[model samples]
Target: MALYGLGMAKGLLLTFSYLFRKPFTTQYPEKRLTMSPRFRGNTFVWYEERCTGCASCAKACPLGIIRIVTHPRPRADVGNDYNVDVFDIDTGRCMFCALCVEACPYDALHMGGEFERASYRREDLVITLDQLRALPKKPQTQFRPHLETAGYKGDTELDEHDAGRWSL
Candidate 1:
């Protein structure tokens, strides 16, 4: 019927109107898209020196993906009470909630801005203490307002001293 054809023509016109417009999707790999300030990315940046071995990050994780091992310090009263021996984060099952990052009282843990970590094996996704030590400390400003105030836009990697507002 002519009425049916009219509806079809309207749909075709709408499609054509948008066909020449700029696409909303970014050309990935060729051009990296900038994430928002509060984006909870998959990558994590941790500074061990600032960590107090309190296991606060592990306790705050809703998925229980973080596992920490600590030993009593020789002189507990001297500085930090415990010496962190192990800090493992199973990113394979992480939800990217950012709860652990916010719960760290010592400002040692932070969510990184990059999300390009793609691995074929599940074991490769498990981040150990050694791997954490090697990872670049490029922290995103999700909850830590101090990092944002310090002009950390999450684009560049920072050293331990500059990562947190209250340095360890």
Candidate 2:
């Protein structure tokens, strides 16, 4: 029967076709895939200037991974400015829920796009304030209002406003 070997021939042809096609698998270490605009990465970006030390982010964390310790600083206008003494997020315990980011009213907190957070010790995952501040600033696209109302509307483009309210 002519059809008997046709199936094998087609299978071989399909296999051979892949040789010329571009690979879908990325050579991870050498070539990294660009993360989506909405992707909630593990690294947290903290804008020290915008942070009011309200402890809102800490309270919103479901896992209690965020810990904030603030001390009052005498201010001429406000009477007392809350200076954030300790702002640490135990990333190991974090579930990447983005709850903390949502609770930040000042837009001081945002999730970064850096995912290469592998570490040998658990202590290394508990990100300190210094580490958070040291991270390169990224867009603050993940907002509570945007998320709740679905305002993102499939638009992943980060605008000036969305790009980490630094100037504000």
Candidate 3:
């Protein structure tokens, strides 16, 4: 009987403990919590004009989630160039290891820190070039030089010989 009474008292104390305790939940959307610097959220990258269509990213992806299609530039073009006709990344299968980003010789890809990746359908998770490009550049605190170099710099060509030179 004493043990039963003691258990009841403990339960009641725990219940009362919360009566004056401040609520830990914050109003989401309006009040967001800052993520830590090392947080690995959604994987995103810049489609910098420097992407040589070398297909290094596609090859580096272990899950084969990255798909890229390129077309030949006109022979009159001075430097090697290809039109990126298709670039798709299935976020559903991505492990976010950032191997693709590191494999890029032109430093075209980088990890972005946006964690709200909820989706209702699988197709919605497949990000396209336009969608990835539309993401706002992260603040300086999270900035990486590899990502900043994605801006358009007029017509330029990638040196084919240098594509395979980068170490992953």
Candidate 4:
């Protein structure tokens, strides 16, 4: 009969152990959690300097939310192989699958890390070429293993020729 009250005593001890501990609460807006290297945030980081106008990213999108317009400029050897006239990404319907980033052969596209993209209207969420050009170049390295292997922590911006000639 000595073991009769043993179960109850153990349960009581477990409850009391947590009774004096402080409750856990997140300090939202002030202290945000930094996403991991492979997080595909609500934004897209498109490098116009590296895009070859191949439209592979758009083709890879299962939701068909990516749009691109490019003029053939084969004669001129410059920033990109074609003159990208329009680039539009509808963020309102994106599923964050990261497939587009993987389809990019030139490594010109990467997922952004900022998640404060709450908007009042859907139209306001559409990422145009101009906005993409202006947004901070913070690649989250979602599916790009080379960047991760290169030790890109997604804390900084990626600039021109950052991938090097052959990538690491």
lDDT for each residue of candidate 4 in 1-168, tens digit (9 for 90 to 100): 678799889989999988788857669989777679788778888888888889999999999999999997756545436889999999999999989988998888888887788999998888999988988888887777778888889889878567423642
The alpha-carbon root-mean-square deviation between model 2 and the true structure, to one decimal in Å, is 5.0
Native-referenced Cα lDDT, model 4:
0.84
Model 3: per-residue lDDT, tens digit, 22-111?
Answer: 999989999987665434567574544667788898999999999999998865656657878888889888898878877876656655
The number of the candidate with the highest lDDT is 1
In Å, residue 86's CA in model 2 sits off its true spot by 0.6
Residue pairs with colliding backbones in model 2 are 140-164
Ordered by TM-score, highest first, the candidates read: 1, 4, 2, 3
Candidate 2 whole-model C-alpha lDDT, 0 to 1: 0.76
Q: Over the stretch 15-54, how does candidate 1's per-residue lDDT look in tens digits? A: 9999899999888889987777667777789988888899
Stronger candidate by TM-score (2 vs 3):
2
What C-alpha lDDT values do all the predictions have? 0.85, 0.76, 0.66, 0.84
User: Where does the lowest 10-residue lDDT sum fall in candidate 4?
Assistant: 159-168
Give the Cα error of residue 83 in candidate 1, in Å: 1.9
Clash count list over all predictions: 0, 1, 0, 0
Best by TM-score: 1
| Every candidate's CA RMSD | 2.0, 5.0, 7.8, 3.5
Off by over 4 Å in 4: 1-17, 22-24, 74-80, 163-168
